[model samples]
Target chain A: MSEKSPEELYAERVKRVLDVAALRVPDRVPVFGPYQLYPYTFAGVSFKDAMNDYALAREACHKFQDYFQPDLDFGPILAYPAPAMEMLDIKWFRWAGHGLGDHVMYQYIESENMTADEYDEFLYDPSHFMMSKWLPRSFPPLAGLAGWPAVRTFMWFGWTGGYVGLAAPEVQEALRNAAAAGEELGRWFDSIGQYADETKAKGNPQAYAGFDWPPFDIIGDTLRGTREILADMRRRPDKLHDALEIATKIFVEYGSGAAGAELPLCWIWMHKGTRNFMSDAQFGEFYWPYLRKGMLALIDQGIIPVVYCEADVESRLEHFADVPPGKVIYHVSTTDMVKAKSVLGGIATIAGNVPNVMLLSGTPDDVREYCKNLIDTVGKGGGFIMDAAVMLDEAKPENLKAMIDFTKEYGVYQ
Target chain B: MKEQLVSAIADMREEEALQLAQQMLDAGEDPQAVLDAGKEAMTVVGDRYEDGEYFLPELIIAGDMLKAIGDMVKPMLQAQASQTEPLGKIVLGTVAGDIHDLGKDVVGFMLDISNFEVHDLGVDVPPEKFIQAIQEVNPEVVGLSGFLTLAFDQMRVTIEAIKEAGLRDSVKIMIGGAIMDDSAAQYIGADAYGPDATAAVKLAKSWTGGK
Candidate 1:
C-alpha cells in the first residue's frame, strides 16, 4: 500500500468500528447498550452504596464497562446529579448500602404545583429540573465525574410519548413537570460543560467525551413506562397536547442551540407495549413534529442525530424515512435483525437488538453462535453494530465477557 | 420572569379569556354564569386536543383561565356543595420513594374541571397514609402515581396496603404515570389505570357514577 497519512491511519482503525456501521464487511459487532441500569445484586452492592460511595458506584459500573468494553466510551457529562432520585425521597430513595432494598433507584420526581388541567404542560417540562439538590445529596455527581474522566457523557435529554388514556389531577402535574423541568437543567449542564475537555486522558478516554445532550426523556422511558402518557392522548387530548408542546420545545432548543455539537443526538426510549395505540396520523401529530424538528436541527448542527430507539421501528420506518443516511441510527429492540437490515437499507446504522435474557443465561458457545448469526444476518448490509436490545440490569458477568470475546474475534473483516 | 399560569396555558388568548369572562359576567352574569362560561371555553380547548388541533399549551391556558374563574367562583361552588354532598372526594399523591408531582398537578386540574373534590397529599407518600386517607376522607377513589422505574414498587405496596386494610371495595384506586404499565396497576390491586389526565377524569367520573 502507498504511504498512509496519520489521518488515514486513524481512519483505518476507526473504520473497523465504522465498518460494522457501514456494513462494508463482516465485522466485530460492538456491544453498545441503551437504558442499561445496574442490578442491585451485582457485585453485591446496593443502589444506596453505589450512590454514596464513588468507589462502589465506579466499581459496579466499571465491572460491566470493563467486561463489555462497550464500543463507545463512558461519557462524563452524565456523571452529574439525577433530579428525580433526590426530589422524590419517599423511602427507597435513601442510600443504606447492601441487600435487596438498597438496589432501588429513581431519577424522575412528581410535580408539586400542577393540577390535572395542566397535566400536559407538566409533561412538557424539559425533563430536567430540581436535580441539583439530589446530585449533591446522594452521590455527588461532580465528584463521580472526577473518577472516570475519559468517557464521553450523554444525558437522557427527553422522552417521546403518545397522549392516550388519562391521569388524575395530581399525577398529571407530577408527570408533566417531569418534562417541564428540563429548561432549568441548562444551568447544571453549564456546570458540567466547564469540565468538557479538562479531563486528563486516562486509559479510559471514552469516559471523558462530551455529547450534545438532548433533554427529552423526562416524560418517557423505554425500559420504564409511558402507558399513562399514551392514555392521556386519548382521554384528555387537550391537556396531553399542552404538555407535549412544551416537552417538544425544550428538546428542540436542546438539540439546536443548547447542545452546540455535544454530538447532536437523541436517545428516545421507545419501548414495546403500546406501539399500536396511535394511528400514523397520531404518530405524525403527536410524535413526529418534535422528533423531526429536534433531530433535523441536530443534523443541521453538523452532528449526526442518532436515535437509540427501541422495539421494531421497521413497521414505522416510514415515519423516519426522511432522515438522511449517516444522520440517524435507530437501535432496534423487538425486530429481527436480518429483516431490519433489509428494510433499513443502507441509509443509517443499526446499533442492536440482541436479547440480554439469552446472553445472560446462555453458555459461551451459545453466546458466540447467537452473535455470529446476528452479525451474519444484519451485518450483511453493512451499517450494523452489535448490542443488547437494552441494558441488562442482572445480566451475568461471565456471559457478558463471552459476548465481547466473540465479537472481537469474529467481527472483523481480516 | 414568566407568568407561570400564562405560560402554562399558552394556547388560550389570555386577552380573549379576560374579555370573555368579563363580557359574560357584565351581562347580568352570576358567579356560576362566569364559571360556566369559563368551563365552556376550556371544553373547546379540550375538544381541540381530542381533535388533534390544539396541544398542551392551549389546554393549559384553558385550565389557567378556568382556575382564574374558579378563584372568582370557589366560594359559590363551595357554598352550593356544602348543602349537597361534596363535589367528589379524591385522595392523591406520588407513591413513596417517588417525589415527582407534575402529573399529580395536572390530574388535580382535571379533577376540578370534572367536578371532583380533590385531596392532594403531595409526593413521597407511604402506604400508611394511603390507608389513612382512605379511612379519613372515605373518598370515592384514590390515585397512586410514580414517574420513575425506581418507584413502581411504591405503587405495589400502597395498593396492597389498601387491600390489606380491606378498603379495596370502599375506595377504587386508579394508577397512572410514565413508568407504570397495566401490569403494575393489577399488581398494586388498583381498580383501574388512568394512563393520562383525561382517562383519569373518565375513571373518576365512572367511579362516582352511581353515587
Candidate 2:
C-alpha cells in the first residue's frame, strides 16, 4: 500500500461521505473531526492569544493537521473578534485574563439581558429593538444606543436628534473601534477560508457550508435567556409562540438564500429543546414545529441540514420523523448512540457520542475501545459518522490519534 | 386570601400576586404570614419543576416575584418580629472558569425560599473569591456550580483552597450543575452531588440538620 495521491484521497473521502449521507454502504464508515478548541491547546497557545492573533490560530491549525489529519475540520475556532469585544467592554462574554486568569478559556455570561415585560416591543420591530434595546443592554460600549431616537422614527422620517450623538467623540470612538474590529475579523475569516482551501487541496474536505440556529435556541439563548424563555412558556405562551414563529420565518429565509451553493450544508445548532430541557408536550408544542418548518424549507432549496443535537436527546428523536429520509444529518452529543441508531438508522446519518471526558482523561486504549464499539454497532450497515460527544478540545493527542487509527482499520465494511 | 396569594404565585400571575400581597397587608395581616404564603407558593413551583411542568423560566419568574413580595414584607417583619432566625447560610457560585448560571440561579432561588441566606458570587467566580466569601459570609455550606467539562478542575481547586484556608471543616462542600455525577463530585472532593435544584436544597437541609 503506497501512499495515495491528494486527488485520490479527496475523491475517496467525498464519495465515502456522500455514501453514508445517503444511507448507502460505501467502502467504509467516515470519521469526523470534532476539533473545536484543541488545536490551540495542542500548540501551547492560549485561546486569548489565538483570538488576538490569527497567526497563532493558523499555527494551531497547522499543528492540527500534523496530528489527527481528520477527514473533515470545523471551519475556525474563536471566530468572535477579541479586539472588538475588548474595545466594547462587553460583559456578556469573558475571555482569558478578563474574568478568569490568562490561561483559562472563554465563556458566555448568561443574563436576563432582555426583561419579560419587553416582549411586545421586541416582537413588533426586532431590528429596532435589537439596536436600541438589546445591544445597549448586552454590550457596555453600545450604551450610547439608548440616547438614539427610535430606529423607526429615524428610518421613516430621516431627521432626528439621534444623529447628533454620532458626532460625539466617545460615540465616534466606539463606532471607529467597531468598524476596525469588523475589518480585522473579515481578514481573519479570509485567512481561515484560505486555510480551508489549502486543506481541501491536501485531500481533507470541509463538511458544513454555514451555521444557523434553531428557533428555540435563538429565542432562549439571546433574546429571553434560558430561564426567562422557559417561564414565558407558562405565563406568556402566546407571546412566546409569536416570537418562535417570527424566528422560524427569518431562519427559513436566511437559510434558503444559501441554497444550491458550493457547500450546500446548513449547520443548525440545537439547544434548549431536548428532553433534559423540556417536557415531551412542551417540546412538541414550542420547539419541533418551528424548527421542522425551517429545516423543510432549507431542504426544499437543495440544502442538507446537519442538526447538532446537544445534551440528552434520546426521548426527542421521534420528533425528527417529519423530515424526509436521507436529507438530514443528526449529530448528537450525549444520547445513547445504540438507541439513536435504532431509532434513526435509515432515516438519517447518525454521528457522535464518544465522550469528551474519556478523550480528555482516558488512555489511548479506552478511546480505541469506545470507537470500536461505535463502529461495530452503528457502522454495521451505513449512515454512521464517527464523532466525539462534544467538540474536541484539550483532549490527549495520543487518545485522538488512537481513535482515528482504530476507526480507519475497524470501520471497513466486509 | 392566603390561599389566593399562594395560587397567584404558583400560577405565575405576577400582577395578581402583588395585588394580593398589598390587599392582605392593608387588611392588617401579619407580614410573616405573607412571607409564609410566598414560601408555600415557591414550594409549589419547585414541585412543578421536579414534575416537568415548570422549567428555568418558571423558576426565574417565581424567584423574581418572591423577591418582590419579600422586599415589601421584610421591612414590616424586621420591625415587628425580632427573634425569627433564618434556616441556614450558604455561599454559591458558578466556579472560576465557567460562566453558565441557569442551574445556580435555580438552586439559589430554592434555597432563598427555604429561608436560607444564600450569597451568590455570580458567574466566573475565582477560587480566591470563594475563599473570601467563605471568610466573610461564614456559611454552613459552600456550593461550586459549573456546566462545562473544565469546571471539574475549578471545583477541585476551590475545594482545595477552602482546605488550605482552614475552612474546610467549618463548612460542608457540595457541587452541582450539568456534566456533574457522583464520580465528578467525588473527584472534586465534594461531600455530595445534587442533580437538580430541589435535590440541592434537600442535601443542604440534611447537612444543616434543618437548622
Candidate 3:
C-alpha cells in the first residue's frame, strides 16, 4: 500500500484525554495495541528491530491506517530500559507487573512474604538498579509473513511493573520511602508519556486516559493489587471498607494520570486473573462497591470511565446497571452479547461484540456475515463502534481487510 | 392480592410486607397469586434492567425482598408442598480455590425472583459440600460458579461428587461465571449452562420448570 502525507489526511486533532466526565466526537474509532504488528511487520521490522530504532515504525502506522483506516493509530514500541541497562536479576525474580501480575521484567524478588515486617531479607528495589532496557523479543514464528494475520496478544505478557513506587509490602513501613518511589515513578513518566503522545502511541491530546490506563501493566501496579484487597472486602467487610476507602483515596491521587472528563477512553480490559466470572453476590457484596467508589472518585475528578467489561459480565450487570450513559462504554464479550446489548445499550455506548475466533478461523464469507450481523445488531443507533470482542491478533490479512472494507462500505451514515 | 406487598419486596424490606403475602396465601390465594405479586415487581425491575432503568443496586434490593419473603412463606407450607413449590430448588456457590462471591450473589437474586428456592452456600465451597447439600436438601438443581482456572478443577470434583453420590440423575446441574463455557459444562457433566444471571435463571427454570 502507498502512503498518505500529513496534508492529505483529514485532521481530527487527537491527544490523550484524561477527563472522563463528558463525551464528544473522537476523530474516529480509536485503534489501540499492545503490539502494533501490522505496522512493524509491514516495515520488515521485527518487534526486535523496532526496539533497535522505533521511529522506523511511523511508516507502518501510516500504511496500516492507509489500508485499514482505523480512527486511532497505535505503536507497540512502549519504551523500557533496554534489557542489559540495569541489574535486572531476571534469573531470580521474573517481573510480574509489580503486584497484580501484569508481565515480564526485572523480577529480582528481594523478599518473599514480607507482609510481617520482615525487611531483613533481600529487598527488591528499582532505586538500587539502573534503568533496564526493554527490548521486544520476536513475534511468533508464524507472524511477520506478508499475509499472516497480525495478532498481537499483550493482555498479560508485555508488562514491566516493579518497585517504581513501593509495592504492597512497603506501603506500611518507610511511608516516606513509598512516596519517594511514587515520585520517581511519576518522573519516569516524562518519556513514557511522551511516547504516549507521539503521533504513534495513538496520542490524542483530545483522547481518553492515554489510551485506556497506559496499558494495564502500568496501572495495575499503581492502582493496588486486586486479589487480596478485594477478597479482604468479603472476609472482613468493615476493614475492607476502610482499606478500600484509603485505596480509593490513593487511587484518585495516583490514577489521575490516566483518563479525563471530556472524553472517556478505556482499554478492552482483559485478564485471566480478575475476570467477571466471580459470583454475583461476591461482585456486589465485596468488589463492585470498592470499584464503584474508585470510579466515582475518578468521575468526580472529571473523568469519564469506559469499562470494557471483560469476559462474561452477564451476572454483574445489575450492579452497574445504574451507571449513567455518555460516561461509560462497554466493550462486550461474545458470551452474552445479546443480553449485554439489551441491558446496557441505553446506558453505555456499545463498543463491540465481534467474534475473535471467527476472524481467525472463519472464511471471508463467515467473517463478512458475522461482522455485518454485528454491525447491524449492535450498530442500531449512532453510538456503536466496530471492533472485536478482544484484541485482534495477527489475523489473516485478508480477513482484516474484509472487516475494514465492510466497515468502509457500510459504516458511513451520510 | 394487594399491590403493596409487591412494592415492599421491591423496596427490599420483605420482612415489612411478609404478612401481606401470607394473608394472600392463607386466604386460599393461589400460589400463582403470590408469585404474580412478586413477579410483577421483578418484572418491572427486569424490564427496567432491559430498558436501562434499573441498575445493580435496584436489582439487589429486589432480590433481597424475594429471598426474605421466600424464607417467610416456606415454613407456612407443609414439606410435601415445599417440593411442588414455586420454581425448583437450587444450591448455589462459588467454586474452590476462589474466594470471590459477588457474581454468585446476583445469580442467587436472579434465581430467587425467577421463583427458585436458592440455598446459598457462600464462597470457596469444596466439592463434598455441594454433594452434601444436594443430598440433605435434595434440590432439583445445583448451580456452580467459578472465575478462576484453579477452581475449574474443583468444579470437576463437584460434578463427580454429584455423580458419585448417585444424585446426578435426580438433579440437573448448571455452571456459570467468567471463565466457563458450554464445553466446561459438558466436561464437568453439567446439565445446563448460564453465561450470566439473567440467562442463568432462565436456563435453571428450563430444567426444573419452577416445580
* Best prediction by lDDT: 2
C-alpha positional error of residue A91 in candidate 1 after TM-score superposition, expressed in Å: 21
Q: For each candidate, what is the lDDT?
A: 0.55, 0.79, 0.52
* Tens digit per residue, CA lDDT, model 1, A73-178: 4432332333433433232223333222445543432222233443532443323222322222223322221122111122242211212112334335444444
Per-model chain B TM-scores are 0.79, 0.87, 0.71
Total clashes in model 1, counting residue pairs 3 or more apart in sequence or in different chains: 130
The residue-by-residue lDDT of candidate 3 on A302-397, one tens digit each, is 565566555656666666666756566556555466676677666665556555444444467776786677656755554556666554434556
Candidate with better TM-score, 2 vs 3: 2
A40-85 in candidate 2: lDDT tens per residue?
7788888777777776677777777757766776645444557767
Worst ten in a row by lDDT for model 1 chain A: A143-152
Stretches of model 3 off by over 4 angstroms after superposition: A1-10, A13-66, A77-208, A211-231, A258-277, B1-211
Q: B75-194, model 1: which lDDT tens digit per residue?
A: 545346223244678999998866667678777766765668899998878889888988999999898887654455567778877888998889888987754445556655678887
Best candidate, DockQ-wise? 2
Candidate structures ordered by DockQ, highest first: 2, 3, 1
| lDDT digits (tens) for residues B1-211 of candidate 3 | 4688777665545455677887877787656556667777886666555444444555655665666656755666544343335678889998764556667877887777666889999976888888889888888888888654434456878888778888888887888866566655765668767766777877777887642
True-vs-predicted CA distance for residue A379, candidate 2, Å? 3.5
Q: How high is the lDDT of residue B189 in model 2?
A: 85
